[model samples]
Target: MCNEGCLIADLELTFTVKGSHEGSQKILLDSDPSLRIIVFHCVINEQTRLDVTLPEELADGNETVKSGVLSFPLNSLPVQKEIIVEEEAGVVNKYNNRKIIANLSGDLDVRLGFNLCMEEQEFLRKRKKYVAAALKKILHLEEDLKEHEVPVVAITTTGGGTRSLTAMYGSLLGLQKLNLLDCISYIGGLSGTTWTMANLYEDANWSQKYLEDAIKEARKQVTKSKICCFSLDCLKYYYEDLKERTKEGHNTSFIDLWGLVIESMLHDKKDEHRLSDQRQTVDNGQNPLPIYVAINLKSGYSAQAFREWLEFTPYEVGLLKYGASIRAEHFGSEFFMGRLVKRLSETRICYMQGMWSSIFSIDVMYVWNLAADSEDFWCRWTRDRVTDIAEEPFLSMNPYEVDTCLFTPSSVLSSALRDVLTGRPTIAQYPNFIRGFQMHSKYLESEGFSTWKDTVIDSFPNKLMETADDELSLVDTGFFINTSYPPLLRSKREVDVILHLNYSGGSQTLPLDQIAKYISGQGIPFPKIEISEEDRENLKECYVFEDADSPQAPTVLFFPLVNDTFKKYKAPGVERTPEEMAEGKVDVSTILSPFTTREVCFSEENFDKLVKLTDYNVLNNEKLIIRALRLAVARRKQRKY
Candidate 1:
């Protein structure tokens, strides 16, 4: 069958003729096994006539063989000519005017095929126009990006709740162009739920670079005079963790110092229903001890440099007890918070799967498992709260209150800091907090910087290809587990096997029903079967039973059947037969019966059965389908580069 969204054409044909004398004549032709015959009607020129002579006695004691004369329509053409027949060469001719040759030789034969001659011409005309339009838009966008001074104009995406590995691979390629691998550093922690969440902050390096670029761009506008982004929102995660821990009156070992400072500012307005304990305290006069070493921004921290500092932090002591020394270095501050036995007892227990819930991020609020059922929990987790430090200015101002308050350079820093500090550094008004933000945003927009939504949605496909590798091998399977189901298929952590049947080959309907029957025979558990009506109709065209044929594609199989015309018919018998007319016989002509039958299975065993019985002509078809399936599975399992 022709592929969907495609065009097909037939360019040549061969016919065979047989005869003994003036009164005997017959015709035959070669056929292709790959294609199943769908139609046999043809227009014959009026010039040729065929007359048959009957032998005195027939083999079955009947003299009916070739006893009559047959001729094509007369007076339908401008001229008429005598019939010419070639017996040895299997060629047939009409007055030697038209060409004829022996038919194709094969056991699984196809006498006719559908041609898409007109459709092909139309497709070429339209495809050219589509390519031209898409090219113009892409070129225009590329030029706009180049004009802007955007050093790292990357498209970012998230997988599960973590940043997508595809984006990272693309970024690496871009950086490689400039040979900046050494100069640039990637930082971030990955959560197990990277495949389940699409949250950026939970990515191992979400705040590592992209966030750095964004925060720096914002800061440059805030400073007007030009300030390189020296540090990222390293404390952002800590602050989020703190808010959750401080609810209890006592400091939970899990409360990182930075989180505590941010949480303390919310002392006046207590909400018990909130995720964190709603305990209010006075000045708390007790100085919050640093759980981990606070690094000076001046000393840049690289993966190598961090190892040296980890040697000194008191946080390392706790990791030694748990025999997770390497991991302690990974968490650093979080490990510091985990050290206090008192804090662990007071902190609320929460279970989070996927990357987002475990990671700290000021940018992304939170992420939940696709299987997560608690709406209340999900809603509370994602509510965007700027940091708690900005809520109460007076309390945040005291150096002892919190070492630093992370305020947007626009509001809190310019207005509140200016009034609080007796004498601040003399700086240019160019970086007037709020105004700078507007200038930066306007500059980016004027340069045609697209929103994150557009970049990821539009360029995601291209970026994803960057992570693809041909070396990977994938598993091919059917009957995907539906994660939408609750309690059973939804939260299932294991993979289940399935059967896939083909519907593109001959006698398709019969094969499908046969497989379905086999499935029911075995008490194998499966999801409710959903059969498509369009597929049922297409099955009539498949004819594989005669040659034990099947579409090579695992999804399409065919079976063939024999008929008196030497033509083939295949398809499952229908439950209802058509009504007979006064002649007492149903007209087969109007039924448009199947040329073949095809069947589908949702079980692996059924798939094997189809494979074993597949028509030999298209031996490689199933392999092709298997390859495509494997590729898809490989894509799903690939990790970020």
Candidate 2:
């Protein structure tokens, strides 16, 4: 596919292309991701980027580059062309007539590293008042909680389709009621929980305001019929949305269609808000930073075999393993060689929400067998178009090195359109910003990429080349680990406490065990999450894990979705009356839960029960949560960064 970006037309190299006996003795006839038009840089300098715009008449079907400027449609690709130069050197360059487009240039928007982005850094400063007030009010601090002694506290939840989407509302409501939401530094999610985050973030001041109304709204959404999403009219709506996106040079796959359904389910009317728009909520740090999680899987590989962690915040969208990130607004825009070449319209947040929680995209059993550790989902997207993919799709390939295969992928939208025809699940690809860029030569041997002995492609030199490919195939993190633990564990985040709400709903396997194994392999400092098999048979409302071996391991307060003391009491000390007893008898069994992983509909009664149960679970454990927070504060005080 033709990259919809800019290129550098060199007049000095044009002479070499015309069989010149003498010139610079170097010919650089290649594709650059940032240029458009055939406007040649007649000056011999190959490194300069000129700020020249083509005249308006250039797009009037001009035959070729003329009057020192080449005009072509923005969507056209470059092809072999004979150009005559008016320069004294008699420069002439030959490239195919395929039209190439130029991208707007300025300072790059990407911020590369493991450190937090500047916006997030500025937010921490703004959040000091709210957190101190929360500590005093929630913990009843005898003295002020100093800003310097503050601990980075985070809350995380797992995915279980609609089950998670609704239960998360209850979980956050619980936090808000207890005044715990104000103390959190970050709130992260996987799959289903993202839908809840997207909904709440729209309110901007969601955390500062009372949460009952939001939970009530959630009740309405869950109780309503999801049948309309599959109605004939909805299909037409999806078709039109995708078609319009394609015309605007954006990619549209089956996932895009799924996003529209999610959009309708969450909002009755059109909500045109993008993720960047939510920056208003955290711009002054009134709320916890939101981190949405996904995993990057290679095109031809099984998720179990190769998967990398990806995170989306209102400030940025990036892959942590590569330590590479782009501005949140640049997510879908085309990028080549570390520069934003084509700025496609930022996708609506609904589309991103769909990608984060698209459990229906693949077979349920496949998701269960390959995964099923804790998270719940349906059809898993595994691409079968292996042969059709470019052999070294991660890196730029020369024409002669690879056969003249009928290359189909041009822009991401082109591949997305292909997915529509085949009816197979998509890889949720975006333009790889680091495409055409190489990793550190010693990346394999460095402590950065891998500290463990996994045989993953990124670990081996020959196989790691795939990291340089042109598109990123990001899928739900559930396809690998069932939780969103990796991003929070990044060392620079300096998190002291993690309130992990296990909304993933399945009962068989321990999700934390899966997370522990993955985190250990990545060499992150995390509390030892060891739960006995006996404990597995019977879950509790909450369990706290802390590091006895190392202080760096953040304390974890894990609350599984189990109806325990909430069924026995109205509050911590208040016993339930006979009529109220039934209110507490909410069933969250993996098999019998009204909020099952695949459950899309819930009665108002059951919905309230789920929300209340989750709320009670948090309320009952108030002392434990506070103790964890105090411990986190002490840990923060003793540790020196």
Candidate 3:
């Protein structure tokens, strides 16, 4: 199990000899008659050392018996050792040693390049075939077309806590009903939208037919009381599991507890599923490629600071900002000095989902309030202690600031309080984003790969040198751009149409504007989002934007979850008014709210209505959807010629 050139030296042993003596002759006994002999074999440096110990009784009182040490020259020792096994006694069933020899003679290629992994390349090949067939049917074309004629469309869902989860489901169902889902090549999601995507992918056969059932199950889970998270049994399980993870070199924190909460709402228990586990569901190329998004945390940057988006797919997980990529299976494994030091177990899907949708980390105060009201004294005391140290600050500020404060404690009591609140592990103890190089000098020499040499490295400070380790802490992408655009805009994908499913409670234009600004800043191409003042004043359910000059830019089909055209009622935010509450609308004012104390958990009827509203928002905009499809098809065909 050792790497090349690993050394081993020094050997010591103590043995008690036992044997019976023959008349007038001291005899070293063998495993027969009245004596037993045991032999020990030691293998080192391709040599063997054998030591035989005789029974001590044979030398107990014999004057002729004497103990002597035997030494063998390194060169004289045999290079091979023999193993004897007794089949009748069943001493040893089999014997074999596993040896792995690797050749590292050539110049190492460490350049960061932009290209899809083999799995994604194969997926695209099959997916394009599926897309072409679906498009032929959608366009009602009689003739079969070449693969290049099919468009690569990516539909991205926005982040808005649980609201987006429900709305995304409805929108997907609407697309399914129009037979448009089969035409999508990729589906990108961030925050709550990732939650829905993660759950949907859990079932391999998921489709529009199963959408209603999934929604019903999700509503059942979400509408349930938060009491389960604080129950003695649940608390015990969390305590034991977190302790185990901490012992195993994992970074455990209160955010992990949020993962537990999410697990309960989504999978009803701790799910051991990995992101790559979803590959089975999409291996046949029947479903759109699912990409979950997160952002890396800079040392001194605020959540609003524009950061690189870390994209996660079933095959690979990495950053498009620097064109760096790694196999998804190796995400949490240890990588040191441009090589893998160790390969740890793949991270659970719940943990990855928790990290991706960690906007819930900001709701510590609400969680504390819930804890304080719990019947368990331990829960109440723990919450009280946490609140006593930093209540007002955490309530007013974002979770990223709170995390920084937790790491940089000002006083002994604050340090103790931080330890208690963060589950006895420092921020550095947790697993983080993998780094390209462990040493700053090596990073400077190689520039973290040629693609990142001039651009990505210059954009950020030398925080790696300041920190003892090379990894970076990452959190939810909603902290930067709520909509996931960077991953979708990867040059390799060449997406021709991007369906933006906006479920934010804010102005409908805000998400699109933020995405457009972010992509422009990053030098990633996308159609300019030009929303007129009139359009903003009277927002519609869907809007289409195209870049006529740049046919390569994907046509953006923005669908903001709105109530103006679908229903008379307005879409509620985290909080709701009395009238809105009375109508049985969602009022998640006390649940997993992103930034405030107000949270909303929709009732069954209202949840159904919200689903219906989202469905109609897409279904009612059939003309616009058709027109966007036509434009994408025409543009794709034009490119083919």
Candidate 4:
């Protein structure tokens, strides 16, 4: 794809070599490979433009008190001075044996920049119509609501394999029944719940249609025989899929393999669905715009110290923190210094799903344990309470940090494949768009990057910009926080309400102590979470948390996946008979529970039980939900006045 004045070199970091001596610090080039040296450098014209050795503050560290900040409505990017070191040897083939003439084509650069893409801006303008109509209908307002006056309502669902997938459908079903589905302006999720959003968006008019049929189809997929997924034929299909993706110059990892497995389990055939294709679902403001989330973390960076959240929409894939984005179709394409170097085929939605929900990157057993622990992690927090020693191991061994592994390959193929991918990092790779950008000198005091004093390395400017590497390691947002709140929290979004569904293995959905701390730390406006000790231990099905003192903070309605009244009343006021009462007794807390995150093949009965529970819970809480919506509108009007 390169014409002239183009340089392509493979960058391999060798940690073991330090002047032919063994060490843990990473030093590029040579053999030792024992020491991990952290350095950042930029090169132009086969010469080093800038190189800085990163500090050791984040090398061995835990979570810190870095205040993450983001500026909204960035209409202009920081003007950067490009430095080009020149050499006349570029046109001459000194490295190649054959003399070749270079093609100097017109400099028609295509780089998605810091300003919000035009596509999203147009989407917001169109989406307002739907929001206005839905708000007027649901709020029972006689007068038609003005488009600008409409409150931005978002629904955020967390991830948990099939459990979340089934529950998401049920929640949406209930919303549709209540005529509240259209009221939502945006819907987003991470991990398994993304599956629900993907499948729904495949149908352009899903939000307008009755969701019962979709639910039934999802139920079938969830209940099918997963054994065949690992069978030889499916394995061959996976091999070919990976082979093709690799041939296309895509980085293949265990995550890709898991995506193929997920494809077979959730889909009947290979699909051409891409994130960009979903624009049709929201083209006429007929459906909520979907925001799928993934996070970026460097290989050696402290998982706790740094997290770069990437939000994907039909229009663009962006990092709200940096105010930088690329067109959705250009997401996986190679880029350098704010220019698209090479264009790869847009990634299929299945692979996107894999990147969004990459829990299988490591071993399954450990993931299950993490799920079992994560359920209550939110509730077990106090402002004074630190993540106890018991939780350290889980925190330290992030899935991306662990070696990628495979399961259930028949005969020797599985073994051979496992060996080939055994040591690769557990993350999907994409060319970093932020590459070649220089960090602001006084960024330590900048409003965008708050000067943090709490963390060791996070306090350093160079370390904060260290993620400006060649490739971005995008993995499931579950690595940072399971909730899909980050993207919605962007100041530009101006969201007024958040309906958070905890479909993962969690007893408490609102886990305010944890979620509150995280949001407050980032300087985002969120409701105060003050659950009493009594409430923390025993979570309620629905919670409405808000900062009465601060109207800017969005009102959050948290719904945890707990078996509550759905047991006594199967379908919102429909009482279960003596014989059918057993159906209400859903095992939501056990590792072997029907709603376990680890189980892909849920029995039909369990699927119904789980799906119905979410459906029934939403229906039962309809009055409360509507009340919240009304309050949100009232607040929006108050602000308008």
- Among these predicted structures, which one has the highest lDDT? 2
Clash totals for all models, in order?
Answer: 58, 31, 13, 12
Clashes of 4: 12
Using TM-score as the measure, the top candidate is 2
Q: List the candidate 3 regions with Cα displacement exceeding 4 Å.
A: 1-4, 8-112, 303-306, 368-467, 568-600
Write the residue-wise lDDT of candidate 3 on 402-497 in tens digits.
432233224443343345565522122233434433233434444223222323334344553333444656677777667787777877788988
Tens-place lDDT per residue, model 1, 260-376, is 222221111221221112111101211100111111111132222221111111112111101122211222121111121111232221211111121222112111212133444
TM-score of 1: 0.15
Off by over 4 Å in 4: 1-115, 364-416, 442-459, 464-468, 510-512
Candidate 2 global CA lDDT score: 0.70
TM-score of each: 0.15, 0.77, 0.72, 0.75
* Model 4 Cα shift for residue 226 (angstroms): 0.5
Compute the lDDT for candidate 3. 0.62
Residue-level lDDT of model 4, residues 114-206, one tens digit each, is 445666677778888877887787778999876657788899888888888998898898889888888888998889988899999999999
Report the error of model 1 at residue 503, Å. 33
lDDT of each: 0.22, 0.70, 0.62, 0.69
